[model samples]
Target: HNRAGKGLGVQLFHSIEALKTYVEGPTFEEPVDGITLIQEYILSPESYITRCEFVGGNFVYAVKVDTSEGFELCPADVCQIGDLF
Candidate 1:
């Protein structure tokens, strides 16, 4: 998922240049004080993240966000979603 266009949505980067392009657009120049980080990355077979919240010790709300198309999941009333979208 760290391909050319997936960086902006998920922070996934194929290389330093790709990350820079996402930050500064197509024509990107290296910054003098830019920060770089290396961390453990795990690949998940499931292409989605489920967020759940509870209230009063009871089940409240849950949502499943698809990761195949992109990473940022917009809340209801502001975006469109579905298996066919």
Candidate 2:
């Protein structure tokens, strides 16, 4: 789900029970074939995330992602995602 963008497989759980239910339920699915990673969510004052692209330790480019639209950040038309962000 790398290019799917907008935190496609990301989920936030406030409690252990909720997380368990999700993991046990059928709704919990991942397109990727690998381990499911659990991590803490950092609260952001702004409704966006910045991604800096680099190649071989050299800077390539950077973009400010607008998360107000629920994390679907791929701007490419091939993704058929949404409005440009």
Candidate 3:
């Protein structure tokens, strides 16, 4: 929470109205002002995501995020298990 802001708060939505409400509703302060990201949600088995880190063309480490708790992917108290293409 302290390192990467509030992380991804309340990412999953069941309906369009819910998503709209969250988009328009109040939220915690972002680490950067006016910086928010929205994306198409996809369903996946186990609700987990894998992240790979690379440094200087070398693989460093990998993390498999568990989204059952929430979308915050950080190692701190809070995280987001997002997919990028």
Reference-based lDDT, each prediction: 0.58, 0.71, 0.62
The numbered model that scores best in lDDT is: 2
lDDT of 3 at 82: 43
In model 2, which runs have C-alpha deviations exceeding 4 angstroms?
1-6, 77-85
Per-prediction TM-score: 0.41, 0.69, 0.52
Candidate 3 has an lDDT of 0.62
Greater lDDT among 1 and 3 belongs to: 3
Please provide, for model 3 over 44-63, each residue's C-alpha lDDT reduced to its tens digit, 9 standing for 90 to 100: 87777887778899999987
Q: What is the lDDT of residue 40 in candidate 2?
A: 85
TM-score-based ranking, best first?
2, 3, 1
lDDT of 2 by residue, 1-85 (tens): 4433445667779999999999899997765655577778787999888888788999998888777766566644575634563
Per-residue lDDT tens digits for candidate 1, residues 1-85, read: 2332223324567787766667678644343345333444567799876777688999999987776666555545546646654
Ranking by lDDT: 2, 3, 1
TM-score of 1: 0.41
Q: Candidate 1, which segments miss by more than 4 Å at Cα?
A: 1-10, 15-41, 53-60, 75-77, 81-85
